[model samples]
Target: MAAVTMRLSEIGQQLRAFRLESGMRADEIAARLGVSRAALYRYEKGEVIKLDTVQRLAELLKVSPLTLLGIGVEYYSRPIGFFERIRQIEEETDQILQIADPVAYLVTSPDYDRVLFQAIAETQDAASGEQYASIMAARKSAYETRRPTMITMLPEQAVERFLLRGVCEAASPSPELRDAARRVAAAEISRIVEMIEAEPIGLQFSVVSEVDNTANCMLMRGRERMVLAINPFRADTSPAASTGVSLITSAPEAVNAHQRVIEALWKDSLKGKEAADRLRLLLAEYAIR
Candidate 1:
């Protein structure tokens, strides 16, 4: 019963999002569906919905039945408070295991917050990106405050690319800003380097040469939740300003599958001294560029 209720709520949220995305007002949608505005409101509020009504709603919203069903995962489209959502999940989760892209986020480096502020400050697009910047700042605060355990996978080649050229639109920051960002990025990786040399508890770091980046995912062990984030934006791209998508689910089967994938990737990843050596090689190359 509880699972059904949860699924219903997820579906409702997705329906509302799709409707909004379609730019169809509730009255318009309700009238087309041969329902009153109150009935339409009930549908979006996760009230019991019939299959036929769902199909009709799908047609009205120009979405598939599966999309309206919340069949496998709950989808979020450039969610307004995306970082806040993650922050909420993080507070509940005791540990996070992430399969990241080259420039993975949620870093625990001592100087990361400073770098973040500088990047936001130096960027001309900050005003246009205010909502993203604010949410990102809040997310950072939440993580720093909660200090949840995290295992992060960093791709050696990707880090090299990141150091040489910032991700997405961040590629063209002022030389001073770029250089500052580079030094911070290098230092952040170096701290990971030190961690590789000196293994730490509660936090684990790995660098892989072979890209196991089939999908970027976060497994929140505490919340029994897994986040499948298909971000079209790069690491430097603010998720809030980007058109990427994220799906979250507390379904045990999905979580288990994600955990298995993370474990396999972790096993294949380079760790400790070997990973440290890889970072050194990259840094040496970066020194010239």
Candidate 2:
């Protein structure tokens, strides 16, 4: 995550520097790219750059793609930079705020049961299953080592759909897939509710409204933060292709902005007993008694 963020930021800064050096305004660049000035601003701010756009920028700026990507000679040869940074952040986070359309499970944590993890894995494509296992194991080790605080905000409809239907309507395929998903979803939902009820490490769960288009789940660890946004193309077809970008920052302003967004969502979401009641209603609607 840190690697991704650092690279993007570096690239963004480099783009801005080059643009200024060329004595061109943002509007001029936006006009050339056929994008709005606001869109260009987002790129300059280091939000997330598309691969094609990076290529175009490299061509336009007369810089190598690797340099634009911040993949300095040494780092480019390594395969572990991205995952290693994620592990480091997990170990260091004092608190984590997770906002995801579908739930984000720390597989090794008590928050998720092993059976549920396997069930979810069964629904994945072969490659996804392999990746899931590796991620689950790594997350488990991180949880055991760090024991950071966790708060999760999920979309109300997703919870309702999963609990009432006993499966993720979005992930369903054939009848067999539906059944497998249902068993896993029900059990995982129950486990999650129970964990929240226990309030271990001040854990909290809430159902937020108006999250339909939100596909990313964020994890904030002290001065560092990571956001994993789902790849729609991957989800629709090859589960093994599930890809996301993780953003990391120690910048006070950036961290504060993310914290504020999480807090706002939390305030707008259901809380404590109210949240539990909502979960129960869904369970009853699904006949999970």
Candidate 3:
């Protein structure tokens, strides 16, 4: 199941590459296909490329269907293309607005200790010392070359739980394994906060009862915006699973609709000092200290 999902994701990446090489704009492709630009954008994002669209893209790119689908080769044998696209987006984005409910660290500038924090927070049993160390090293390397203009909206309850559990405390762990996890989480959270404070970025928080109701993150870039809506529980259970149904489109109307939704949410959100105060209040309520 993992291999299949990975292959499909790779194919999406290859399709995007070919589209770039062919010098075809998404709008041009959409016009040719008699669909909205947004629909074509969805195809590129690997949001369920239809069989017919796959055939058409193969015909257009001059690649065989099997090669594009990545069927005959090892799945991990190829590089993950979506990561490269993410890197490209980070480099090119003038601004980023991230809404994270369950976790707050994935898109932070100075990087978050995603693996260690996730492991500790999700498990009652401690991780191995080696596992904790390896995740920290990987986290450091991943953040070395990329930085994005970021605005993050996090739910209050998630933050409260994170702090109350001492997820960010250096003393939370006793054994070597738990200690390593604790240290990593504390360091990474501090680093991220510092980076955000030093940059011309925005970090906000709110108590949105509707946050969990919405099941995806929205990335806006220039005139192009990508909406990634995934079922969280399903995704957590199967980390490598493809988004069952993702809608990626560059149609002006669709993009406008998403933008409007984002704007409305932002307007209702707390930013700057207000956001910090709210966070402090929540932390106090949870007795984080």
Candidate 4:
């Protein structure tokens, strides 16, 4: 049936995602599974997959069988894997609805990338840092080319904190890095203010006081499917990619639940001049400090 074929296709897609996250080569996985490399590639291309094979692949991939089958949540503990998954989903997305507490990385200026790299590069070796840089660049490029309709809700308290601590809050940062971080924060927030005032097509920014959460939640909607990602890994905050677990799911129930929450909070969010003025006040208050 058509329905069964579509389900297989989704499962194949999930297989590729988990494979990327696991960092295992297709030939290696195929060898372990006692299948040919060609067969593994075929499975990833939506060929028929046996239930027992799904179970074995789940074990090999370190994910639950339900997750492999697209029937349960996809868990990601590494920020690189999580963001890479997001980048993959965004490749096909036409609309993005997000609640990225302080600001969304997509709207941030280039200087923001420099600040982020400074934070990540501090803890990583040269090679790992370069890998992270590539992922960031790829994400930015995907957004530029796709130009998805994005509606983002930001928390006011989070913005205040971002202005206070800057993007990278190292345990003991040098004076120069601290100052640069604050300057980048100010510039990034000012850019948000400009966006609010401009009301650009296909982009919307709203500052909300009630949503106190710092986690990033996004619903990426494509032509045939939508994905919900709840990520604790923040690009701005520079949290270790390994420290926190993220949830990615496509179940209708979970999607509907998160949609309800977004809808409720969006009603009370401030936009246009009101939002811009609020951000300006924060900038002034922080600049005086």
Maximum-TM-score candidate: 4
lDDT of each: 0.65, 0.56, 0.47, 0.80
Better of 3 and 4 by TM-score: 4
Candidate maximizing lDDT? 4
RMSD of each: 5.6, 12.0, 12.6, 3.2
Extract clashing residue pairs from model 1: none
Q: What TM-score would each prediction reach against the true structure?
A: 0.67, 0.57, 0.47, 0.84
| Residue 49 CA displacement from its true place in model 1, Å | 16
**Candidate that beats the other on lDDT, 1 or 3, i.e. the better one:** 1
Choose 2 or 3, whichever is better by TM-score: 2
Candidate 1 residue lDDT tens string, 188-265 = 666677876777667788886777345667777664345543333444554334366667666677778878878988
lDDT of 1 at 274: 80
Lowest summed lDDT over 10 consecutive residues: which window, candidate 3? 73-82
lDDT of 2 by residue, 208-272 (tens): 76566544445556553443312222111222332333334444565566667777888988877
How many residue pairs clash in model 3?
4
Judge candidate 4 against the unseen true structure and give its global Cα lDDT, from 0 to 1: 0.80
Clashes of each: 0, 1, 4, 0
Arrange candidates by TM-score, descending.
4, 1, 2, 3
Which candidate would rank higher by lDDT, 3 or 4?
Answer: 4
RMSD of candidate 1 to the truth, in angstroms, is: 5.6
TM-score of 3: 0.47
